[model samples]
Target chain A: DVKVTQSSRYLVKRTGEKVFLECVQDMDHENMFWYRQDPGLGLRLIYFSYDVKMKEKGDIPEGYSVSREKKERFSLILESASTNQTSMYLCASSRGTGASYTFGSGTRLTVV
Target chain B: TQLLEQSPQFLSIQEGENLTVYCNSSSVFSSLQWYRQEPGEGPVLLVTVVTGGEVKKLKRLTFQFGDARKDSSLHITAAQPGDTGLYLCAGDVTGANSKLTFGKGITLSVRP
Candidate 1:
């Protein structure tokens, strides 16, 4: 079975804090994506990487950055977290071009 | 603009009841995928429907894609308590490279 592992299940941080969420997949997929899931808003893509060291901004990338130094690992970085940034963060990987994506368990971040 | 709209934001019914979830979109898609998410967990891919007017069956769940590639539906027969979860529909808008847009998701609660 393909597995996407998220670093944290839950996170609590103060406003203006820097946060990092990690994701690793065992399937060796070529495409990786990060998204934030909110009620009634669905999953909005924040960033995606097609290859190691190559990244592209998604529909919502403000205040968030990504790192993809390895093929199987992708990370979502919040430079300065705010209250609005508190949401469920999901990581997914795909084989690229017309392939279904496999998603991780998701990390729920609460900012106060 | 919201690309996908899922009807009946929340549905609670008896375990033996049958239910249907609808996903509609104005934009055409290359493929549509359905996922079931449990509380505090990431979504698990349930089925993927490609080809317009296609129908796929998995056990008690039946999925159908619209002929225009803009909508999809899932019907469950004899729902079980274990089937309770959030159902999400995602579309590959570009039809390539795996850039997906997701629906807000439908929450289903099947009581025993």
Candidate 2:
């Protein structure tokens, strides 16, 4: 079975703090994505990487950046955390474009 | 902007009941996918409908894509407590670099 592992399951940070969320997949997938899930807004894409060292901004990429140093790992960075940025973050990997995406267990972040 | 809309944001029913969730869009898509998410876990792929007017079944779960490729539906028969979760619908638009557009999820609660 393919597994996508997230670095943290729960995190709390103060306002103005920097945060990092990591994801690694063992499937040798070519696509990786980061999304934030809210109660009524659904999952909004923040960033996606199609290949190593290449990243693209998604709909809600403001204040967030991504790094893909290796094919199996992708990282989401919050430059400065704010209260409004608190939400459940999800990571996903796909073998190719238009293919089924396998997701990691989400990381719930709370910024105070 | 491509957008997918899901109806009935929340539904609570007794076990053995039947229910249907609808996903609609004005723009046509190459494929539509249904996912179920549980607490503390990532959303799992339930089904994918690629062809217009296609119907697929997984045990008690039935999925259909509209002939125009602009809509989709998921129907559950004899829903059990295990079926309680969040159901999300996503659409993959045609053309290269197709990014998925997700709809606000439907929260389903089944009571015994």
Candidate number with greatest TM-score: 2
What is candidate 1's TM-score against the reference?
0.95
- Flag regions of model 1 displaced more than 4 Å: B94-97
Q: How many angstroms is residue B101 displaced in model 2 relative to the true structure, after the best TM-score fit? A: 1.0
Q: How far off is residue B69 in model 1, in Å?
A: 2.0
With candidate 1 superimposed using the best TM-score fit, by how many Å does residue B38's alpha carbon deviate from the native? 0.6
Give the 10-residue window scoring lowest on summed lDDT in candidate 2 chain A.
A93-102
Give candidate 1's error at residue A106 in angstroms: 1.0
lDDT (0-100) at residue B2 of candidate 1? 78
lDDT of each: 0.93, 0.93
> What lDDT tens digits, residue by residue, belong to model 1 across residues B1-112?
7789998899999989999989999998999999999988889999999899999999999999999999999999999999999999999885455687788899999999
CA-based DockQ, model 1: 0.75
RMSD of each: 1.4, 1.2
